[model samples]
Target: MTCSPPAAPGPPEPPEDAAVTTETVTEPVSTPRERRGWYFYDWAASAYNTTVTTVFLGPYLTSIAEKAAGCAEEGQTCADLHPLGIPVAPGSFFAYALSLSVFAQVLVLPIVGAYADRSWHKKRLLAWLTAFGAGTTLAMLFVTGDRYLLGGALLVVSNILFGAAETVYYSYLPQISDPDERDAVSSRGWAIGYLGGGLLLLFNVIAVLAGDSLGWSTAEIARWSIVSAGAWWAVFAVYAIRPLRDRPPVETSRSRSVFYAFNQLGRTLRELGSLRLTLFFLIAYLVYNDGIQTVITLSATYATEELKLEQTALVPTILMIQFLAFGGALLLGAVARRIGAWKAVLASLVLWAVVLVAAYFVPARAPLQFVALGAAIGLVLGGSQALSRSLFSQLIPAGKEAEYYGIYQISDRGTSWLGPLLFGLAYQLTDSYRISIVSLIVFFVVGFFLLLAVPMRRAILAAGNEPPRLL
Candidate 1:
């Protein structure tokens, strides 16, 4: 494997007789303040992941959708109904919401990513998307019992903004870290993110418990959680805005606009055949990440529905995983130093496969399953995600980081439905949750083998040689 040279300094200056004046240049170093600002975006955005996506909002929305579908005349009980054109069932509303969110993410993230790259205001674009997501999350507070449509609409909007912000965030990685320090910087960002997200989640958990003691209704607690998520997002985003500098826009033809970004994206897709290893890595990532996302999205639901775990117990368990993931991400960074980032990711995939198999056998034993699964997931989740970000940052060409990362976001969000579809099928077919857990292992195994075949260093070199394109 051949490594590419680090980015060179500016060209030598012309002699005094030179006719044209040269443009002023800035040093390439990423300052500590700027790096901290970048990491704070992760901290700000992760509150949504912890409080809304992973823990509180999903279950609460599902419950509301179900109750709203309940009979009005009976005032006792009613059959479950599915909204969003998904199949009618008690849990199906959440499934529909997840699928819709994933679908929108697949469509919107790449386009926005490409557009952001062509424009000078990447951070400004990110701020807008963040605010959109935060506002939508706060809007969820108004959804009461039987307000399934309202809740679903809010989720769709929030999730779309969330996914778009992520594309912007990942694209910024290359700008913020020198080639030599990429992995270390990326790892530190993930570590800080986990710590921030976990700490906030701990506070939310306490708030929920305290609300119960204070005789707050379920709706009141849910509303408080939703409002707090938005506040958290807005507060932390201030740091990101203060220190990060935006790259100046590259000059283009008069025809270029947001729509033209898609044309550039088309060119990038056409050229993908020249970057064989990157293409392969994308395929592999799509498969395995599907499983990873499914696990994260569905774990709470599985615990509540299958294991009969209470919301109170499940929330704390999820919080524990968040804290544990901080250590896990740091350890994996060390592992990456010992081995390569690619190999460390492979090891994590292998661990995931093993953990999924274990999940199959231990579903009935709630306590042991909770502890075991949480630890196993915590061990691999941060490492796999953070390292993948660093590795991909290396592969993108020097000037087109945002454009390529947009394509990367497509892969991240596009095939997200497969795992959930499979899980739903397994549950429907066998009426058994165990089979659903077992089915995800295939994604990890297949992705691992595919990853083994890709040559990372070669891909980086090829990407370096390519002309910058928005996609």
Candidate 2:
């Protein structure tokens, strides 16, 4: 983390996006302790993303949904579990849950962020959302028997809260650091998140491994592992919540009411369209990030369903990916320093395409083959996401980073709906996981072409910043 001081303490201010046409406002540098605090939130929250959402929940929830639907396990012929006259397959249950959360996020986050920028309660809001989300995650422990809807409700609620909290938390970035230091700080934070996630995952692996020896069922271990994730999220979050304080809530005339927040959002959207390169970049990020997120979200499900990998093999591989991504993010940062963040991201996108294609053809029962595919994914996962954030930060017009990033997260969650929806639809239609896995390559390909059309120099110039040093 960088060792600079924080922004001068001041009242909250309205977004000055009109100045995007003129000059950029320079940012005050942030302290290392504050940056570390920021990084810890990522570290804290990642346990859920790592253990529950990625490694355990997919298979565990699939099993619950499958059994509820009167099937032994989710497979090519698993029965569809319908609720309210709509068929919900085990393979698609979590996907639909995530898509539903994304829908809620797109509606809720921008408004929350606008309010956060205008209010003094940013940290308070972040804490409340984190606790609420983590509490919902903890509720997963009671999702026993055929109560899949209860489980799905908790997961979807948790996912929605996670997105809302992140909108406020991410707004803190530009507040904490200069654009020049953002790449390194962001990369290190990703590395730290990976480390935290990997360590927690390691403990979960041990729990699962020891369950049989301790006379505990595998399902019991899975439930405890999920419960542990919620505890971890709630505990580590205190690190950021403690030392960090929010800028005094600026109750400007436009910010004094909910109606004004919506109007501000409307203006931001209208003005956003005029910013050509930034708009294109968001579109490209939405497409490519959809592919990235889908792979991360579904990798466990795909392995369990298509590859037939046991939990013992799957958890260890996930642990390996978590640790490897730590190094991968840092390594990619160095490579970006030598080349450029954008080009490095492009290279990672190519690797993502390769991983998807390989997943389509890889042997279903081969543990080593799945591990190999996972290693390749780990190599690109952290770097691609970290660099994308750092790169986007550089293009944000000053005084409007929070407002624009609200849109950024919206785009992020919005496109997320597409990739998983497509994945689930493909599976629903064909009962073929291979077809679903390979289908994501279209996102990377389309994103690559669209990203190529973005002119970085003009984008930076329009944002009134020096052309990005990291890219």
Top-scoring candidate (TM-score): 2
TM-score of each: 0.88, 0.92
* Shift of residue 232 alpha carbon in model 2, Å: 0.5
Q: How close is candidate 2 to the true structure, as a TM-score?
A: 0.92
lDDT of 2: 0.80
Candidate 1 segments exceeding 4 Å error = 1-28, 71-86, 250-256, 411-415, 465-471
Best by lDDT: 2
Off by over 4 Å in 2: 1-26, 73-77, 248-251, 254-256, 411-415
Clashing pairs in 1: 68-146
Alpha-carbon deviation at 236 in model 1, angstroms: 0.8
Deviation (Å) of 327 in candidate 2: 0.5
Error of 1 at 464 (Å): 1.3
Give the TM-score comparing model 1 with the true structure, all chains together. Answer: 0.88
Give the count of colliding residue pairs in each prediction. Answer: 1, 2
Candidate 1 per-residue lDDT over residues 365-454, each given as its tens digit:
377568778888888888888888888887775556777776676545222667877887777667677788788899998989988888
